[model samples]
Target: MSIRILTAALFLAIMGLLVAQRFSLPPELTVRVAASLGEDAGYGFGEGLRRGSVVETGDGFLQLTIGVELENLDQAKTILWLAPNTRIELERLYEDEMTIRFTRGRIIASNETDVPLKIKTNYTSHLVLDDVASFVNYDFLETIHVIPLSGSVQVNAGSSESLLTPVPLAIHETDPVTFEKLEVNLEAGDAAEFYRWAGVLTGL
Candidate 1:
């Protein structure tokens, strides 16, 4: 009967949708706030966040009052640690690329997948290499201070581009350094280790 055929078609469509979702990249990232991160920190991750919250891409900006860890789903396999007082937005997400807009603050990024992670700041955009640990810091005035621990990052601003090794790239916001090689006294991995946070954290 015509009714039976229509029901079968509807069932087939549902199954097809399910199959597609099963193979696609997960649309959300798990947010974990440490117990020490005070209650104010919860207000920053405000996309209907709860314990073990999973925030989807483009949910809105996350302005943290304390440091928190964002872990991608098992399929994506990436982790981002957002430092305190940091504000960032999940810019875009795709099967082959993931991007984050750095409004301010620091992010310790570890990308495990081959999908290139792109970080966009006010002055420049950086392509984080796969399997590399990167320490990205964007302050209110300093703007940029990226330290690649192992691999290099493709720093781009408009048509300019450069693949920079583990070197200090600290510059004032007015003087944005895009393609040029910035040399600082600190070697690679030293900044990430010795760079001090502004204040001490004490839990009650």
Candidate 2:
């Protein structure tokens, strides 16, 4: 009888240890603040960012004069450009998913891995995914622009949704969320300018 009691006690102790380990394990993934340019381009959570600082954007503007890369969170890479007035924040970030919220500005996201990327703006949300995909999110005053530079993406606004290929698309903030495609296109000069801006910032 004493032997059986001892065995049961050992089993309980093992189970307790297992449970403690399970709950105490460190997080598998984190959003590393890879690089930042310009002044005041810092993170929330009150921790100073170095090469591998895990942080999230705060309420104020990113103050990104050149560019910033929020990388290595669940195999995702997000490049933010020089938006002086735009408000950026990271709403949720986990092992399998990430949500980026911003008021106005532009961002380049490269998420060709297994983890999914979600961009939340003032009026629209975009799900970005592809085997070898790259996308751009440009938030204007009255419109939100989504450009699929390489692969494809799914754009969602209100109750409406659409799949975007390598075309430039825009979603008006006042319109109902539907699968309606607007006639707005990124002009050649504008595209050139945008590419130039992105290229310059990327080089820095």
Backbone collisions counted per model: 0, 2
- Predicted candidate 2 versus true structure: per-residue lDDT over 15-127, tens digit per residue: 99999998875443444444333443454322223322323333332322111233323233443443333445655655556566756555556555466677777777877
Query: Tens digits of per-residue lDDT for model 1 on 1-204?
Result: 999999999999999999998788554443443212332344443223332233222212222211123432333345555554566666565555577777665555656567777877776787776644344455645557776645677777656545555554654445545333455433235333322221111110
lDDT of each: 0.51, 0.50
Model 1 pairs in collision: none
The count of residue-pair clashes in candidate 2 stands at 2
- Best lDDT among the predictions, by candidate number: 1
TM-score of each: 0.54, 0.55
For residue 25, what is the lDDT in candidate 1? Answer: 57
